[model samples]
Target: MPHHDGEQNGRGLSFAKRIYLPRTIGLSVGSVCVAVALYPLPWMHWIWAMLVMHAWVWPHLAYQRARRSSNPYKAELQNMLGDSFAGGIWVALMGFSALPSVAILAMMAMQNIAANGLRLLWQGLLANLLGAVLGFVLFTPQIQLASTPEEIYACLPLLVIYPAFIGWMGYKVALKLSEHKHVLSRLSRTDSLTGLINHGTWKDLLQVEFTRSQTLNRACCVALIDIDHFKTINDRYGHIVGDSVLKALSQALRDNIRASDLAGRYGGDELCVILPNTDLDLAVGILERLRQIVENQVDALLPELRISLSIGVAPYEQHIVDAASWLNEADKALYGAKSTGRNRVVSAPCTRADFQGLALGV
Candidate 1:
């Protein structure tokens, strides 16, 4: 199941990358437009065209950044506001240089309103609208001082619409990018089979828990659980039956464990459970109940088949500094339980002297 999830997560990341590439291209184009607008040339018409193009492309850049950052809505909002603010500042700097492009700006704003949801569109529209009004108030007088009414009228539309249009575009792009990145992130952390954390994820979580335990001086227990006679069942009943058994056992473990507990499949026939702030005794009691649940549930799928689990538990101590060392101790106890006879729980020997006499290798 973990393997299956890994495959899905890989695919999701691939898809996200595909979506991101186009947004990057769009941002590059917007950057080019900004450069062109800043250049000194007798290219007012061309500058207006580039400004409109920039407005069209700007929203997507924010969207893509937000997706990569894993916060789509906030990214979109930032993109929208950023574009409007940039446009307002650009007009102010260029002496209201591109005020005649309001129609194009309004069109871009409308596109944003349509592409994003109605609520987002409304928010974007309101923001851009304020920006548009502000740009006109701040720049039109400058236009009056430097150019004729016809020239000012020609530039007025660009000033009024560009800020709002760019703002809306930026937001729309950010949302799409964020959604893609979020899906990829979720796929990476989740196991394919049972929608639980994978082995790697479990290890990472254990390390974190270990650190917390050490810092707070809290007790933590690690349990190594093995499905009894799993190989014999797989050989006799087929791999499909083996898979069913694994799934059934996993569900039972999840159902019986607390929300704070971390349960993950370690490999083919082994599962590990990390119980935070739990002592050896508490962990033993939980595993015993889990063993009974597994035994009872196995009968529902294969009545003739008798399945059981052997559990070994080890409590984290001040002396046990590393997660690996703690896991090894639990594993030794697990092996002891299996060797003594399966379907039993064994607690780890606490003292070094106790372990020295036993030939237990985890």
Candidate 2:
């Protein structure tokens, strides 16, 4: 089973820093080399050229960083920056192929642009085309002055093949980087034994759901479930069997829940379900069916197995205003059901204030 760490947009900054720092340093050194080689060019020309290229890039970098940090305008900023960065890289690469003395400077500009928008394939293609054209133009003087037709023909392959080779390498590198990031992300959020969202992930998701529900006035429900006699199962059949039971139960919960609902392993023998756009009654009905399914399976396998669940359901907004309070209410109700004897669903208890002056007048 795959392990996942909790979801955090910029959580792997340290790892990202480690990977990018060397590349950044390498690019920086290469840029310095380009500046030295282009020393024969006027200083003002060099500075202005660099500035023009960077002007198109810095905003894209800022936008990318902001998007990774979960800025609200991420999608729009991403699209805008993606296009700008790709165009910039293409132009810079073309300039480098045309002017070898300033190749380092052009490489630097291309690197910066590529770092932010390499995910955009169309942009990369445009950059490669620009580079190929610049390469042809820069080498044309030599081709034109060639003593033999063969000499001119010999340069044809380089013009046709080099840019394509470079673009392919760039694409491969991007794919590898994406795969690594994906592995790291999965490692951050998944529980190993149960194959469900871990406790930390659950909390993070709950907060997001709560905020969305509050802002959109959408209904949501939280259900807390505890496996009855879980400790006894572990004691009687060994921890391995107990773990298997937990994994099976987790799959059952996930299969039973709606696509929008999130099920998580909260702690030992305690699982949680978050039902977006669901009322308390709907949540209860779902859990009740889940309980029946689990009960039937357990009975069939271990005929004497007395496994059951105690569930607590609470509606968002109507029951509690915030995630913490909502979870607390469901937990309290779960405890109530457990105390009464398991295998039952209970609604969260309303505060005395909520009962409001209406006494039983018998």
Candidate 3:
């Protein structure tokens, strides 16, 4: 789909050129054998003129026609029909020599399929048939029954080389498709601004970590982090500089987090981390370092502006019912940090009673 851009149908015209050129060469080469096996053309100049145009010139013509047309894809389809028509005409002129005629028709059908699959193949087949009728009218119907050794020898190159060429083309296209799929998969999970896992992907991982901790009976902490006075930063320095701050913070997260830890852009200026096999004290220590990292940083682009973070640490407890509750506890701790003073880490109390004292103690 990426290849198909700029006025939809125009998208695959280059693709059409790829289809056109090789088939043209193969058919042109095959024609020598067909001509020898059948009648020597009385219209020698005419035949050679058509052959040269098809072999040497048609690919460029087809590309230009498609590129210049309002509907390039549709124009290219017409070109494919032209190919089938020419193939049929050649078959008739060769008086239907069995091997050569069948070879030409089969190659036409394959070219049709490569351009637009079975439906287009059927259309090209009809075009070939119509051209055969025209050729019969113009040149008279005749069928050759035998091929000489020389004629057969001439056909050998096309038979051997053409199919191998098509197969190699197919292999390369498949590799490109695989690479595109990998890029799409990465983009779907990543935040464009921070280059961190997006909120939805991070939330999905949070649920998984929560379940893993419950099942394995391991300690884990979830931290919710928010940039302090982010709106003020945006207002004073504008969004471009604010974006730089987010990028810098993302770089810090990338640098500080261990392989086992997962950090993500939760939403806007908020970030979240899932630290498995880590308890409240360790989580607090990690968040404190991160808070320091954010606070001490000055924008490389706007050196006068500085940034800080309010972070909340909540360890998994036996009483926690679900992932949402665990995240809510961390959010409450984050709120505590923000409300008390920015640029600090607050750990949520295990129970409701200890909250006022312990949370504020941060």
Ordered by TM-score, highest first, the candidates read: 3, 2, 1
Ten contiguous residues with the weakest lDDT in model 1: 99-108
Off by over 4 Å in 2: 1-149, 299-301, 350-362
lDDT at position 236, candidate 3:
87
lDDT of 3 by residue, 193-235 (tens): 9999999999999999989988887999999989999999899
Candidate 1 TM-score, C-alpha based? 0.56
TM-score of every prediction relative to native: 0.56, 0.57, 0.85
Alpha-carbon runs more than 4 Å astray in model 1: 1-98, 101-169, 298-301, 350-362
Model 1 lDDT per residue over 134-198, tens place: 75675442442243345455444444444455566567768988999999887887677756677
- The digit string of per-residue lDDT tens for model 2 on 215-290 reads 8889888889999989999999899878988888999899999898999999998999999989878888999999
Model 1, position 337, has a per-residue lDDT of: 75
How many clashes show up in model 1? 20
After TM-score superposition, the amount by which residue 212's alpha carbon in candidate 2 deviates from its true location, in angstroms, is: 1.6
